[model samples]
Target: MAGNTEPLSPRAKLAVTAGKAAAAVSRAAGRGSGSVIGGRVALKLDPDLLGRLAQHLDVILVSATNGKTTTTRLIAEALRAAGPVVSNALGANMPAGITSALAGGSDAKFGVIEVDEKYLAGVARDTTPKAIALLNLSRDQLDRAAETRMMAEHWREGLSGSKAVVIANADDPLVVWAASSSANVVWVAAGQAWKDDAWSCPSCGGVMQRPGDDWFCGQCGFRRPAPSWALNGDYVLDPHGSAWPIHLQLPGRANKANAATSAAVAAVFGVPPQVALERMYQVQAVAGRYDVVTFQNRELRLLLAKNPAGWLETFSLIDPPPTPVILSVNARGADGTDTSWLWDVDYTQLAGHPIFVLGDRKLDLAVRLEVAGLDFRVCETLDEAVQYAPPGRIEVIANYTAFQDLRRRVGN
Candidate 1:
């Protein structure tokens, strides 16, 4: 004879216990979603369950060579002001990172993830975002990505599967030409004088030159018309005499572009210009790129100099007369096979500053410093470099891996 009451199975009892445990942990943490790390583990344990949980959220995918992290974080923060948002805010822009972030969130209306160009297609395949922003691409890490042309080809393929509304930088001829194929695209560009780089029309391989601030090709004559949303003038704050000022804690000319691009993305998300401007002003700086960290009676300015483009822009921001510099060369294999890009950077600007070069590739950096006719001293260790660095004014420039090493050594 069967009992009138149903007995709980072993699996059912385990599920109930797990639910109770999760609730307890959530209360203990004093935060919602319990713990994202635990949630990631749970998703890794069961993908089907994770997918079921993530079906309702809208996704936004943001990509670019530079400024992706800052833009992603800014967008996430602005979206948060509007409603609930889940984001991979820690510069984990890979497909695996995105998968983990999405799986970790228990309740969110949307998901924003920055995607690295190398992995953009893979990410696009997995999550079809409602909107996607493609910032300009520059010559960076040639050994890793081969050439800018190859990177363009990758993006050309990567964007095919995207169903989202595409937002692109029109100032970059290559970016615009590559993205023109997308029917639903919004162009966000800077003023005409801002066209300093694109030498050829990606559309027809025609030699292109800037006539005033407008770019036009000689062969195919592909010209980028004025943008729907364009920022004019050199000042990041009020490029067009607007009430909103471009306030950024990040230093450099590149950061101005980063801030503009972030504002464009935020605009698309329905953030009011006033609110977005306020958000931009509120941001002091990201962790590593031009980040200022204070120690016990010591100040450290972490300037990220990954490649020629980054360095050129970064050095331009050191104001009120230049100071002494500490240069840390890249040692990581991923930085690039060829370290010859140093010649392209303007080392002459630091002529007065006594430079202290340190890193695994300290010899290479020292040789470049000498060749550039800049004052320099070689140091075998970061500690030696820091110890020798003048007390009053010293700026530290490091590539990605070297910055990490220096940070660890400096106790930052």
Candidate 2:
């Protein structure tokens, strides 16, 4: 379903004007980027403001347990080769923030939206997106977010028979199940490193059989679909078996997977795979995920890992042994109230590195580390954590709120 391209209603115009004004006030007040506040105010005046604002543009929505922001950034950058593209580049993945972004980019030709996992269906419905990218789905914010299977079922029901082409990760069983209901899908074999959430089949609720990289449900016979695009080592193979080497400033195999998915989504919008990959290679970081900042006379590479799956990928991005690592964990509202997920992460992987833990939930992390038989020091602040570390480039891995806190402190 394409958005209505007609002129916005009087109410919607008023809402857009009001939202821009509110966002300007928020920026001036130094409260935030004001996307959410502006969007919220606009929606209050006109509930359908998002749909109206998105009417003129072909929108693409990206959602995942991890790498959504990076993939969104990649898609936006790649789509820019086509024309002006508007995106919530600041990691605002909700309705209000999305509305604010669209309100600001009214004249843009395309919209690339980073949608929160829970809100993907709703956002897709509202935006009438041209294409939707479903990256891997894993356990994230367990206390606040829906369980993996439940969320998949929600996506299946909401996106059933949708006109939009879905670019789904064929490697993830949950993502496959979610996009299975869509009439048109471009499957990409994006790697799924974290398999804890996909042990059970979403189809028949039976045990999922994994023979090598292939996944299938023996009882139900639900199997992984052959992908149109496959990530082979350092290259992304196109549908016709053309391999495009992925050279990204971003590290880790996870980012390579994201790039492969981004290329597939970009193809849906008519951007060539080579051109899309070239455009994506320019992106060094996403909303401060891989930013290197100087803090306390030490060079710190900031990495954000929110959940167990995210942490698994982050651990791969860190520097080698003996380079001190700072692990920050917070149980704030944005970080989720439950710190029990910390146990799910393989903290033992940081055995050789000098590990320092800090944040509101540092105690919980420390206990997890202790059980893993890794010695770690608990600090009160990031500065203290840095002070305790040896003199070298430090790798700092933090969860949502804690990462933001450190980012602010480092002025990055």
Candidate 3:
């Protein structure tokens, strides 16, 4: 369902007019991509932009190391049932993106915004949301963001006094520790399949042991909180012990966990489980994730892989062996300047499979693949890469900028 994305009269109309003018200037100036510059300009004009606009409206925030964009999309898909919504549909998590998502429209009853992990506190403090969805935390950009434990600590500080009901992942130790003392938290047993970063306790710096789905810190005695919502296999188990089957167009166990968390968030607004899951089936793609595009005559299933933990999940989505794969990378502002993180990804998953490297960072990616003992050839051009890929749909895994470049080329 398309959102009736007109700006609501919740804020002074002058703020909206000024914000639109900034956006217009940005579009005329041919700034980076689209309206990001415009949004930034608007916020610069009005410091309390989102707070003034989103104070009264129903707002939901989605933040995580991965899946924030996709999960936000899923929640927005269901919240349309409530009323008109304003959301950062372009996967912008910072203030500018949230500003554009909110200031771009008026008369929206609901607002959904995807936030960056580092900026979560500011956004939460600035705007009072109805629900704040905290997904798993892990090591992201080594250059920019804080460590995972530090990220959790910042969250613990930011979320201490919020009135919004917290929907947190019980399986992630970092999330449990971060949301430890929140006044009202609704835990969801959304699966945390990747645990490389969760090896130690965030509180006492002790060993974190995972004993069959539940994690316990041996030293601090912190354990996985009892989840009120769980995804048991193909069924979503309610707090009342009844199970409902939820089918989503998105593939992989990670997406299933995402859907379960999104359903829980939707449930906070009295949205039924059946309705939430059904609407999610319409969102096959989130900002370019899970987007199947015919790029250069080759159908490509695109998934973004920015760091080690995210790479683990993306690798799981690709069909193993004999399925041709395209690996793309770039070191742009959105993507961290440091390409050293490339070594952290478990590229061995593609061992013995036909892999083709593409991107401006193709040479660096090629070196990484070579070190992993994988034999691969380089496809210098997009058409050449598609030709190298096996017939039919090829899995294209890329980082931030490369994926955006590919998406733009595909005319999204």
Candidate 4:
């Protein structure tokens, strides 16, 4: 499969030229936010650029509160078994970013793209993807529709407009509820560990009941659907009940869930289950999530913990006690402006571990640590912080911009 190479309309050609120029200037300025800027300017110049560019593309749109980036990357990697694939790597997930990615990868026939939770609908509607992968819904930004049920409603409406097969996490009630209305659905029991925002039924606002792993609503009688593709511990059981063993180079139960979801999505595109799993096994990291970078004579493994649910997953991967960990948090636009979400994180998971708080919002994390009654110290710089950890691997977990900054430092 190959992307359409036909010449663009005069309006689109002019828009692309201007957008490319803007991206070049932005990148030269070293701001690193140029990817979306170009797309924004392009879309402004030609409003229909996204739909125009999406023509003849076998697009897969993946959206969720967490794991969207990794899941998108995993699916994209698997799709390479089919043909050339295009995606906005490392979580550039917005309308502009999606446009920029499609524009740049003009010859890639298939696209596996990550989209922000709020923008999921527009992208799905525009691209009309071959398959839409729904991971899980969680309370990410309280300032911006922190109520995930509402976002689920938005997703339901958006997906209704899309002509795509929906591959959703059956274990996540929010995801199931949102995707249930879709005409074609493939359910995967990709486990949902974070249930803080899913206590109430999105349909009836009734209290939900969980009997073991299955959940049902008390008042409205909503319940978990039997999954077609399921993840049980170390194996992913297919629709025929054949289990395929999966071993990931990345350590974390969340990555296992991500791996299962990726394989499920790949199957929709005719990629064999075993072949998909093998391809996913090759991923050591998605951007900096599990990359080991040597900075100042110390090996630092970067984990991007953008929300409390994300923190919950990554904390389990941290080396217990003795080894020092550096946590960086920032209250930038990419990360929500309000940092109150810190209160929801179970910081006590690292109760006895030696933690070094870093970044501009290090003090905020320190306050949270103090409230949690955990022992922690402050580190001013990454190089100095690298000195504190003993000879083994040092873990550095940061949110959005902080993670992006450190990733750039490591790459440079």
Candidate 5:
């Protein structure tokens, strides 16, 4: 289905211009990137602005509890092999930010959007995207965001009967339930590391029987679909039984899963799997994530882990023992006011690493670590944490706001 290709009304054009001006003012004031404010202004002036801007572009929306930004970036890069692609590359996924990105990339052939999990359905409805990628669903922002099953229901209802080809993760039960209602779906075995949220079936509310990699609901028989794409150790196997080696600068098996999914989505737009993987190799990091920056004369690799599922994947990316891992967390509004999610993560895995904790909610993390029988030193600042650690490349894992704060301090 083609997007709304009608010309923008005079008011819409004026709204876009005004939004750009507001964004410029915001940048000058050093308040922020200005995408949100600018988009908000334009949206307030023209409620239908996003639709008008997206009319001519083949939009692709990506949503997940984790890896949304990175996957979006990878997809954008891979799609570029076909044509110019515009995206919210800075990790802004809200309506306003999405509007701003669309407005700026008027001439681009494709729109690759990283959408927040809560806003995916609305954004998808407005954009009428050609494709949508549902990565995974787990507990995130427990106090603010809807429950995982509720969110999955919303996705299923919102996407029902849509013409978009959904590229969904077959390993995540919640994702399977969400994309089941779509008209077209291409499943990928992206691998779910944390299955705490999917123990119960969304279809029948029955206990999910997970034996090895296959999951099925005994009551309703809702089981994992055979995937058209699968991720092997170092290769991605396609539906045609062709295995393509994935060589990415990004680390961890999670990223490899993301690459497999990206290749599947890109193929929907006519980009070959080999070409997509080749283009994806150029993306070293998404926003500030996985970017190694020099802080206090020491190299620190930044990894963002906001929830238990994300932490599980992040732990696999960090260097092994004696690397001095700095764990930071915050309870700010952006990080979710409730810090109770810390208890869900298994901190005992870091038992041998020299651990230092710092953030607004460091005490909560420290307590969790202490209960796990791990020793940790709480610090007031990243600088202090670096000072206390023995000299070497430091691995830093932080939540939402804490990661942003450290990224700014490191000037990346």
Candidate 6:
């Protein structure tokens, strides 16, 4: 059925938008195919139609640099444990994507969505979610996003005067500042080794200093407090390969942060800590982000590295015994607007591992890998790259667009 089938009235458009919001409200529903907003399709729907569509459904905008997808999925899962929920559990985080996900469901009380920071204000103005869960902010996709400040400003402006409960990461300076400014704020603290030490205070241009767990501007003395619900202990991996102690589903410390954010957001819905943690261990990673599949009796791990930050975070997870790795970089407009952020990703960690480069931009990755002075075998065909990569232990790191192509080539 066409997800957007509605009458031409303003109220009809709003109902359609709310229906899309419903699709996102539950994890059981996959992404509805009707709302494709990335390129030319974004122009398919009229602005008035789109604005009216946003008027329906209880939208929950979950925005962050890293943990958005996992957190969004986890929040939906936790809410489901309590009762029925609708969510855009799929990786579609934009307006059309959220709309598409929202179109499939009939029964849903809540709509949990992972919104793109660039479009957060617009979506907020349209849908007006019940709660805005602001995860930590960091540098990502500099070309399209411009800078962290721009996105932060847009987020602050989009959420102005909304009664949506503000769930924020208190450890992050940008998030803490934004959350503290809101009267209806619930702070979530998390222990992350990599704090925003590099960014200076936006006000007074003074050095940003960590006076305790809390951070303040050395120049302006603007302070942001710690999170109320913080994960302060050591993280132990689950033996079964799930994200935690259940199955080995999610890998890497970054996933742990994702898990922590999920737990905190779940708590906001009154889901018990034990239930949240249990659900977290039970859920599997969504298709492209750190998904592992077996092909030809060999282990192939597919990790999505969209931006420099995501790439670096994945790199940190490679506690290597020198395995063969295949890295693909594709900038299909759906994946991103620019692919130049590869320079910011630290490929040095993979120096010990033999690398195979593929994709439409194979040469770019090869040149970058070579500039880093690492050894790699470059191939134009994904099959050839898979054949030439590590025989028994293989790791494939791909951006969004290249994943399906690689999966098909490797026969998984």
Cα lDDT tens digits for candidate 2, 358-399: 999889998999999998899998889888998789999999
Per-residue alpha-carbon lDDT of candidate 5 for residues 205-267, written as tens digits (9 for 90 to 100): 999999999999999999999999999999999989999999999999999999999999999
The per-residue C-alpha lDDT of model 1 at residue 403 equals: 81
Error of 1 at 272 (Å): 1.1
Candidate 6 steric clashes: 23
Ranking by TM-score: 5, 2, 4, 3, 6, 1
lDDT for each residue of candidate 1 in 41-73, tens digit (9 for 90 to 100):
443444443234335566777887666877787
Order of candidate numbers by lDDT, starting with the best:
5, 2, 4, 3, 6, 1
lDDT of 5: 0.94
Q: Which residue pairs clash in candidate 1?
A: 192-213, 237-246
What does the lDDT read for residue 23 in candidate 4?
Answer: 87
Q: Whole-model lDDT for model 2 versus the true structure? A: 0.92
TM-score of 5: 0.99
Cα-lDDT of candidate 4: 0.86
lDDT of each: 0.66, 0.92, 0.83, 0.86, 0.94, 0.66
Best by lDDT: 5
| Candidate 4 lDDT, 241-360, residue by residue in tens | 999988789888888888888898899888988888888877888877888888887888898888889999989898887777889898887788788999999999887667888888
- Tell me the tens digit of each residue's lDDT in model 3 across 152-188: 9999999998988899999999998888768989999
Q: Is candidate 1 or candidate 2 better by lDDT?
A: 2
Candidate 2 Cα misplacement greater than 4 A, ranges = 1-4
Candidate 2 scores a C-alpha RMSD against the true structure in Å of: 1.2
CA deviation > 4 Å runs, candidate 5: 1-4
* Stretches of candidate 6 exceeding 4 Å from the true structure: 1-34, 37-58, 191-198, 210-214, 234-248
Q: Output the worst ten-in-a-row residue range by lDDT, candidate 1.
A: 1-10
TM-score list, all predictions: 0.81, 0.98, 0.94, 0.95, 0.99, 0.82
Tens-place lDDT digits, model 6, residues 213-330: 6677877777676455555443422212233332225776666666666666665667765677777776676755666787666678877777776777777765484788888988
| Residue 328 lDDT in candidate 1 | 90
The residue-level lDDT of candidate 6 at 80 comes to 75
